[model samples]
Target: MKEPSPRRLPTGVAAAAGVLLIIPVLALLIVPLYAKKGPQLWGFPFFYWYQFLWVFLASGFTYSAYVLIERARRGERR
Candidate 1:
């Protein structure tokens, strides 16, 4: 009897998930983009508020990526 080969995510799904995961990392890694003191939000500077905003944005991105990967895996199982 032969063993079954491991399934791989489709190229498009993989790429999309990868990009979704990378967006937050890239956004926070580049410092100068949000390194500013103006545009205060409820007394928080742009720099502070910007990072705080990403906390939620990153969560959403991560969840979205996870869902995409899960769906792909489920589809492959069928």
Candidate 2:
């Protein structure tokens, strides 16, 4: 397989860059939402469990994005 070519122009580079730029922002969006105090969830309190659940939820999203990106890259190779 051939190495993917780099974008020649700033516009193309910027467009490619733009997609990745939103990822950090998306990852951070859940942080504040979990920072509230509230009642317990199951045995743990909302503050504790909410952050704990975010770990699994964020893992799911990260895995999904990786799989999708892999699929698209493989498709391009064929």
Candidate 3:
């Protein structure tokens, strides 16, 4: 028996998934937004901590996007 091909997401879902993944990268690229020092977390400056926090958030967003796309692809297949 031949194996079936993997399903693909619709254009809109794919676009949204791309946006979700790209947003964090773009946010990281724009350094000025988080570049600051007034705020501190246990001696960590705003700039340092903000980026560190995003490391977690970015992973979440990426995973969420992956799920979203997968769901969409599955729905289309069904």
Candidate 4:
């Protein structure tokens, strides 16, 4: 008997997932974009709050990508 082949996500879905994952990484890497002290939120400096916000944003992006990839895989399997 032959073994079942692994399911692969569609090219577009895989590219979209890759882009989603890269967004947070690229955002954090560009330090000058958030290295400021004004526009405080709840007494937190812009620098502090900006990075903190990305934590949630990154989680959301990651989750979205995961769901997209999973959906594509499921579709391919069927």
Candidate 5:
């Protein structure tokens, strides 16, 4: 009987995953620290908008990273 090859993570994929995990955590942790008085950028207070903006930024980065990782895995299989 032919044995199936063992699964393993490529270094690049592992590094990408590590970056994806860290960014959001850092964003969350750092946002609150700047939750104080500040000038508005476009009529919105910096304190409020800063945190709000990062929510989208973080989501975008996470989603993009996930897609790239999926693509990489698919390519690896071929």
Candidate 6:
């Protein structure tokens, strides 16, 4: 029988990935930050459009973080 080995992250890479992953969570978590009505984008209120936009931003950030962490993990194994 064999046990799976442990994995480690490079210095600062984990924190960077964590920060990237948290961006969307923090953005939506803060209500007052985007809870507003003003400046419209193609008839869309700032509040409405801002949150909608974060959808893409969140995905991008998530994917980026995933790539970063995965890359570091691959490097750690070598």
Per-residue lDDT of candidate 6, residues 1-78 (tens digit): 757877777769989999999999999999899888888899999899999999999999999999999998888777
Error of 6 at 59 (Å): 0.3
3 or 6, which is superior by TM-score? 6
TM-score of 4: 0.92
Q: Please provide, for model 5 over 1-78, each residue's C-alpha lDDT reduced to its tens digit, 9 standing for 90 to 100.
A: 867755566888878877987887786788666677677777778787878888898888888888877887788778
TM-score of each: 0.89, 0.58, 0.85, 0.92, 0.71, 0.86
- Predicted candidate 1, C-alpha RMSD: 2.0
lDDT of each: 0.96, 0.61, 0.89, 0.94, 0.79, 0.91
How accurate locally is residue 22 in candidate 1, as Cα lDDT from 0 to 100? Answer: 97
Model 5 local distance difference test score:
0.79
Off by over 4 Å in 6: 1-3
Task: Record all residue pairs in model 1 with backbone atoms less than 3 Å apart, i.e. clashing.
Answer: none
> What is the lDDT for 42 in model 2?
77
Report residue 15 deviation for candidate 3 (angstroms).
1.1
Q: Please provide, for model 4 over 1-78, each residue's C-alpha lDDT reduced to its tens digit, 9 standing for 90 to 100.
A: 878887766789989999999999999999999999989999999999999999999999999999999888887778
* Alpha-carbon RMSD to native, per candidate: 2.0, 5.2, 1.8, 1.4, 2.9, 1.7
lDDT of 4 at 12: 97
Residue range with the least summed lDDT across 10 consecutive positions in model 5: 1-10
Which digits, one per residue and each the tens of the lDDT, describe model 2 over residues 1-78?
Answer: 978775243454444545555554575576776566677777787778866776776666566655656555565556
Ranking by lDDT: 1, 4, 6, 3, 5, 2
In model 3, the clashing pairs are none
Model 4: which residue pairs collide? none
Which candidate number has the best lDDT?
1
